[model samples]
Target: MGDVFAAVPGAVVDETGLQHLGNPLAEQRRLAAGTALAPRADRAVIAVPGEDRLTWLDSLSSQALARLQPGVGTELLILDPQGHVEHAASVLDDGETTWLIADRADVEGLYDWLRKMRFRLRVDPRIADEFAVIGGTAGALAGVAPASPAGLPLVWTDPWPDVSPGGWAYAPVDPHPGADRDWSEAIVTRDEEARIADAAARGDLQLAGLAAVDALRVAAWRPRWSADVDERALPHELDWLRTAVHLDKGCYRGQETIAKVHNLGHPPRRLVALQLDGSGSVLPDHGAAVRVGDDEVGAVTSAALHYEEGPIALAIVRRSTPIDAALTVETADGPVAAAQEVVVPPDAGRTANVPRIPRLGRRQASQ
Candidate 1:
């Protein structure tokens, strides 16, 4: 069970064999301090170049990509014709071309989709394995600005300025000065999996495990592709108007539906954060029914025992459900008392005012 143990928090420490008892924050700090181990996941990079690259990608994705300048990057969502999210990616422009870094699983499919749509465009898309990607906290990334090691602007592009506040930089794989590297991806022929793992263990860079990363991401209310989205999900439902949809931008695949829903119609569902009552033995799973009294109002999409908070979750609840109403999350163990905590409220874009909800209290209760 050491492998599974290594996968979860408060399990294993670093190569020094130190163990984290039960403190998530301590583990996170240790991981950040290079004392604990963080798992590295697979990533892929796709390169797009030519005269029509920016316009072509802008036409394809929901964000306004054509306006992206070098030394900047943006997160975008690709939706099907039905307005359902298909994939999410970050695009970095290097003045001449753009590079999309996304999950390894979705790379090939995204490439195929882009190829199918490249009718007469002068753009060329190909996989680039020469580069690697790493991430760190805002304070850790001080002097690392995006520049090409190859002297080719196409090879090194700054994808951090536009999206992140000012702490992340994506650079080349070769050695650099004062860099605490996390994960490195080499080409198939020159794979350096063991070396990277050993370096991570040696405290050179912090390892961001999937659980810690997911916890931070969910806490930030960032919508991911597979976890928070699906085939039937609309961009507006996830509160992705600011990042995913360009309301004033020209036509795209599902622009009509998006416009109509935003201007005239209401989104059927809204994404919300739920704070569990902590009294029940049950923990809800994805697709579990969400209820208010006797009415089934929504479904739970994601849940976790937060690092600080006891139990929290993200659920897609019906718009009709009273925003302040008490709801219940049906878990296998039993019905867990929960209340709705709106991360991004329905009127978020309309007004600068945001309503604050009380935090949920947890205690063991009888079934």
Candidate 2:
């Protein structure tokens, strides 16, 4: 069934379906304008069924899923004890089942972890092989109905850059870049996948690729699990607290660290959008060194050429790196000069104001 996309004309299929037709920039414009659909063959789906699903997931992850109403789209992150992001999932519930769309590379590990955590719960978490995903803006997807098993469409809308209920925002920018992003993903059956592919093959529907999706995502300052995350990633570091993390939610695995960091300290690193010098016509590869003079400050996580933004990238840099600092990205071709646009600022956390308690017994005399 996946090979159906490979038959579509001009598709550059690798292991993932439809990398791009040819021009990613033009494809990005088409995708953003709702004229094209991108086959998200690079994603995996997981289904959790049973009456206990919502509360069970709410107890385990960062989002407030306990009272999740049907057909509402949200996201969650599974964090290690020290609060490093372990897994992330885009979530949508159809009243009877909770559907999770995750990156393909992390599916097996996330599924295994979910199985291990279902000790006494009635929920059955399974890797849903029968479901696949297609992505576009809500308008682009309106013509195509998502799979509705329990009278609700199984579509996961991205809530990026919005402060969800109980979530916090650290980025101080007015009119956030993601405010204009209207991306969503629909869960479809194998038959539906074939139907879409057939439409593309007949030139009845326009098809974009994952590359175009990435370009638009990067332009919107959207952080993707597959591209923006690393071993030491924290939700605050990526401005993911704007959507993914519920700072006031009940205690979960990483709640302690999440609270402490947001209230008392700063994230060690911060996310930045880099406007690369397009005169060289070279986009830095993933993992390319991001440097300020001789000091390598960080690494490029994702890079792309947008329809309007020319060359751009998202990189993780030390929180102390000056926001106004001019940066350079070391690419295989040469060093590309980059101007930093702050996403997560250096003072991203420390929301709480806790007064000192006179340093135990030593400071009483000073008054």
Candidate 3:
């Protein structure tokens, strides 16, 4: 089942399946219209079983999952002590098993960590290697059957860009672009994966690739664990609080930092959408330096050529960088000019508004 999409004609698949089917723009259009499916070969599933699964995960991550109802979908984040995002997962629970869909690169580390954390807890976390993930909007994925191990579909519908219950939003845009994002990932059995692959190869079903889906994600200002996260990425910077962080949730590894940043401090950096100058075939690669004049302020996290938007990117820049400043991204071909669109603004945090108390024995009072 390695790279199930490899047999599809014109499909260019690497370690991650199906980069494109010759035309990325056409693929993007089909995907956006809910007419194509993307084999998420780069994603892996982890299953947590036993009765303590939900509460155990609730105690360990950023989302409050203690009372999670069966068949509902959500997400969670594992943060380091200093509040840096280390792992993130899209979560779904059937009555008997809790399934986590996560970036393939982080699965081993996350599985090991989960195993280590089960200190006599009745939870068993195992990587479900026999299952694979397929992504698409609900409409496009309706025909596909999801894995139903516990009598429930294991589809992790994305709850992005919307403020989840108990979650907070730092981005102040009235109409967030992510409102139109209807993305979901479904866990499929090996048989189902092969069936879909055969259908795609026969030209019976259209398929998009990682590149096309990523472009749509960037356009929606949706941040994903693999594309937007770095060693220093705080959920606030990426506006991930909208879907991932629960403000009043029980204490987890990095809850303190999450509270502090949202209540009294601002994130050191903020995410911004860049409308890149579509003059060349060069798109900025991840970690490409982003600059204002001669000063390097940030780096591109994700960039893509969208079907409708031409070229666009998402970058994390210093919080104090002026909103109106013109920006450039350094690529091998040279500098590409970019216009900035605010995702998280400079004034994003400090929401508590606690009044300052007067100091005791002020000069006026003493006099």
Taking all chains together, the TM-score of candidate 3 against the true structure is 0.94
**Is 2 or 3 the stronger prediction by lDDT?**
3
Q: Write the candidate numbers in order of decreasing lDDT.
A: 3, 2, 1
Candidate 3 lDDT over residue span 1-367, tens digit each: 4687888999898986679999999999999899999999889999999899999999999999999998888899999999999999999999898999999999999999999999998999999999989999999889899999878888889998788998877665556777788899999998999999999999999999999999999988998888899999999999999888888888999999998888888999999988887777788899999999999999999999888777788999999999778788998899988888778888777553323222212111111
State the C-alpha lDDT per candidate.
Answer: 0.59, 0.86, 0.88
For 48-136, candidate 1 gives per-residue lDDT tens digits of: 88889989888988878777877455666688887778877777777776778776667788888888889999998987655444333
Cα shift from native, residue 290, model 3 (Å): 0.8
TM-score of each: 0.74, 0.94, 0.94
Off by over 4 Å in 3: 350-367
Off by over 4 Å in 1: 1-25, 29-42, 129-132, 141-196, 203-205, 279-283, 344-367
Displacement of the residue 137 alpha carbon in candidate 3, Å? 1.0
Tens digit per residue, CA lDDT, model 2, 140-224: 9987768999998888899887779988876666666677899999999989988999999999999899999999898778888
